[model samples]
Structures are given as C-alpha cells and as structure tokens.
Target: MIVHSFPPIIDSGCRMLVLGSMPGAASLQAHRYYWNPRNYMWRILYALFGDGREPDEAYEERLAFALRSGVALWDTIASCERKGSLDSEIRQAIPNDIPGLLADYPNVRAIVCNGSKSLAELTKHFGDHPEVRSRELIRMPSTSPIPTRDYRGLEDRLEVWKKLLEL
Candidate 1:
C-alpha cells in the first residue's frame, strides 16, 4: 500500500498550480514528484524555462525554477492504495486538503490538473467553486509513461504550458 507521507511542496507565490493525480512508484521512492524517466514534465518545463537544457537528476533545481516562475506542484489525491503505478488502479480515494492549501496561498490565480482523472476528483470535491474553477481548468495530458501516446511531444506541450506564465 502506497502512502502519502507528505504534502506536495508548493510555492506560495505561485499564480498557477499544476496537479498530477498521484505520484508514480519512482516518485514515491525518490520522495519527490515526477521522478520517473520518460515522464515529460521535466522536459516540458525545461522548454518553458528557455534554457534548452534537459532535465537532470537535480529535481530541486527544476522545482526551484517552477517556484521562481510562479508555478506550484501537487496532486489531487492525498493518499490511495494501488497495486501498481497505474492511475486507474488508485482506490479508496481521499481528496487532499486543496481548499485549505489555496486558502493559505493567496497568489494562486489558476489551477491546472494534469489529466482527466484529476479533474474528475477535484470537481467531485469542490462542486464548481468558480474561484477555484475559474482560475484555469485546462485538460493537460498526463506525463506518466504507463499510458502511451496521449500527450503532445515535449515542445508542443510546453507551448500550451506557456500560457500559465502569461496568467
């Protein structure tokens, strides 16, 4: 059984919040989000940063970049039991304390869930609070490697993500 031992580290100054459904095994093992290889989040973010640098093992640096750019990171589910890293296997869903987090951080102007699953979970709990809903609700493709071919390539996805910076 996988446990969410800690809340996701988010920047208080973030104007945008990017949420994944849950961390993969790699991420859990690493004690960090988006730690899996072939997960395009790092690549996509690096493109947005305009350094043309590939994502190295330095996750703190990447996270720092996001924070510096006014973006926050987290997942919708606080915890779940899963037989595997597959998002579909997630059961006994427990919603994270998102509203509380948002209340604490005043700068978040938009929320972008990474996939449909996350959107469903958020909507189920929040019940169309436009203050949270109106902030951006884009249907971003998942960065997980388990499901294939759902996402645009790194560069293309980064183009879409760039809008967060504009907001």
Candidate 2:
C-alpha cells in the first residue's frame, strides 16, 4: 500500500531536523508521529531534554515541546509502498526535497536520521547537495520496538541519542 508522509513539524527557530524513513501504520492512523506505545522516540526525547512532562502525555504537549526545543520532525520519503510498518519493506520511495527544506529553515545546524533507512535515503539522494553536506549529519538507531543485536536496550540507544540532543 502507498504511504504518505506528514507535513513537517518545523519552525524558523528549528536548529535540528530529525528525519525518519516514513511514518509507520500506527503513526499514520493516529495522525501523529511516533505514536506506537513501544516506540522509544518519545522517551528518548524526554530523557534528552529532561522536559519534566511525562513521555505519555497528550500529543499537543509532545509537539509543543519539540517545537520549543528547536527540533523539527519530518521524514525522508515523501511517499512509498510499504508492507505494514517496517522500513525494510518500503519500495518505490520518493525522496523529500531536503535541500529546499534546508533553504527554508536556515537555522538548522544538524540533520539527524532516526534510522538506517532514513540515513540511506538521504545519503543516496542529497549526500552531495551543497546545502545538505554543509550541515552536521548523524545516524541513530530506530526507535521501533523491534530488537537489534547492536542495541542492547533503550539505554544503548539513548547513549547514541544523547549526542543528538547536544548537537
């Protein structure tokens, strides 16, 4: 089935752009990013910022915190055909116009990919785009509940994500 991406959550003050490969079925259905209960993205964000608000708060609070923290959420694939919510099953992916996004948000100091799929998509298309290459690019583990041998646990992933918050 074809999956469409959400419009980015960004503002003029955004200094970090967080990119995912695509929204999962749960996120799309909820019309919210990282809505899965098992997903660690929200937990990771709260830990990084010490936001005080619980991770499982209302969607509006999460969105407000991200915007206030100068972090923008978006996805690398504008649209794609994917089975279920697995990034591995994505096909016919159309890349988002990231260069244009960079131009539009001049304060962005870093571009952080939420997982391998998003990193590959960005590198394949915009790796050499002057504006893209100019920013600090980082690749972090996916926040999906699926276990990966490399990441021992949420702690392991948070260690990597801690550096993202500092950037």
* Number of the top TM-score candidate: 2
Question: Could you tally the backbone clashes for each prediction?
Answer: 0, 0
Per-model TM values vs. the true structure = 0.87, 0.96
For candidate 2, give the lDDT: 0.90
Candidate 2: clashing pairs of residues: none
lDDT of 2 by residue, 1-167 (tens): 99899999999989999999999999999989999888888888888875545674789888888888888999999999998999989999999999999999999999999999999999999999988999999999998888899986688898889897567
lDDT of 1 by residue, 32-108 (tens): 87887868787877777647776656778878887886778888898888876788888887888778778778688
lDDT for 146 in candidate 2 is: 87
Q: Scored by CA lDDT, what does every candidate get?
A: 0.75, 0.90
